[model samples]
Target: MMATTHALAGVALAVLVGVLFPESAAGTSLLPVAAAALGGLFPDFDLYAGHRRTLHFPVYFSVAAAVAVAVAVAVPTVTTVAAALFLVAAGLHSAMDALGGGLELKPWLGTSDRAVYSHYHRRWIRPRRWIRYDGAPEDLLAAGAFALPALYVLDGTARTVVLGALGISAGYVLLRKPMVEVTQAVVDALPDEHLDRLPARFVEDFR
Candidate 1:
């Protein structure tokens, strides 16, 4: 799935959390929402590490979160916030990736030969691999399903942002293929220095 979809999922989940647990500090904190949104983007950083191997491990993050919580006793404000953010953001990031039939979980306990693809599904229902990495029609449908309801609950600025995010996500799903083709064609026609100066992620996408 696309990063935008994951991000919106994280935000929507954070909102739901707030609704469900309004009295909890973590639920009320903007940090968790920001962290969740950012966390939705975090797992993709594996692109720089080893794509879908190390950072995608659920146990690894769980242990790290445990440590953070343990240390929070000494610094309640900072560590408490950090722990919540890490759990919500990174946790959901890996989970969304896993749903797409990717992600290597429990990497420490098992060798690469034994690594498992983590997912959420039942025997009666298929997993979330209905869409590919980018430009899946399913992405729009799923995101809209979540985003539209969020609009009804979120008020003022949050509602506006969600609406804007929905537009961008929909645009990306619809235009990604054509945009990639056009972008690559434009980049191909550029001179060496201009191409070299382009952002690495943007250039890498074409390759």
Candidate 2:
């Protein structure tokens, strides 16, 4: 999925998990909660690169956790679990992004990139390495953006789960069509010379 969608999902998931298992949630400290949210954005650091977004390997997650723990020790505000969850959320979001397809997730072992979020590998190590950034499907992005907040509100109950599901459905139905219509309008509004520059995918995919 796109970084935005993954970030939205990660935030909502953390909130939902925090709410559902309030007592057992890893992040007891507010610092950790914030850290987790930040950590969730960790994998996407690749956006700084010239290429698209992709998942870092397990090593990246481990390094992130260790760095977070060390930082927590100095800060003395967050706990081990809190920092760990931050890394885990980032890793999870990276993993889920693969489900959207158009790319493969491979483990980036060795000192390939950097320390924490160095590099990524393909789901398969083929004769020819083919790894690309996998953005979220348009409908999935729209559905996820809405569903995540709904899930957070639902907070993991059966009723809330139902509501979240409905919200996802509604988003898929509404956003996709409206986005297309809006794109058409924009295209029509733009000068003929600028038509080539305005890709419809931008309107549909970019929320």
Candidate 3:
């Protein structure tokens, strides 16, 4: 998986849940969906500071939920519902990371100097799994970061949206990764001195 994948997966799941569950839908408001999309990847802010663990934890999530609830109460419509929707999206993101077969997110904030890694998300028929990092489990929720917006206009049944979005996103990711891989391959062909100047996250040194 990749960052783009995680985001799309999360959006696909949230919209599907909201539309089908109706119970999750915050009425006509798109606020919750927006919040959820934002919250879904809120955890990834951690990557920027290299200390963004809190953006992903239950405690932080609780705070976000409170804010969402407050907005729901204040606006009391699709706006308020947006808050609830956000909670669902963020919650889903966290839960997925927790149960992943190959990945173990920084479960609790302030517990590690570095994020832990495993294959926890790779399980079969897993339950309530979070769609953490779409790119790789070690990463944050990057895929869903993009997927959420694309799915916003997704029309039709929940199942249909998921199927459609999944197909589109998976293809997008596969296409992107190989280009990166090829670019990296070219970089790998370069002499060590030439590669030394490239940034780590840059495609030139995509290891």
Clashing pairs in 2: 1-97, 2-136, 105-122, 105-123, 106-121, 106-122, 114-118
lDDT of each: 0.59, 0.48, 0.48
> Candidate 1 vs candidate 3: which has greater lDDT?
1
Tell me how far the alpha carbon of residue 2 in candidate 3 is from the true structure, in angstroms, after superposition: 3.9
TM-score of each: 0.64, 0.44, 0.50
The segments of candidate 3 whose C-alpha lies over 4 angstroms from its true place after superposition are: 8-25, 41-55, 70-75, 98-164, 176-180, 191-197, 201-207
Error of 3 at 132 (Å): 12
Q: Write the per-residue lDDT of candidate 2 for residues 83-160, one digit (tens) a residue.
A: 666776677655554433332122222212322222545332221112222222453444466355535444336335
Which candidate tops lDDT?
1
Q: Report the lDDT of model 2 for residue 113.
A: 32
**Candidate 3: C-alpha lDDT:** 0.48
Write model 3 residue lDDT over 81-111, tens digit each, in one string.
7666667566555545544332223222222
Single out the weakest 10-residue window by summed lDDT for candidate 3: 103-112
Clashes per candidate (backbone, < 3 Å): 0, 7, 38
Error of 1 at 54 (Å): 7.4
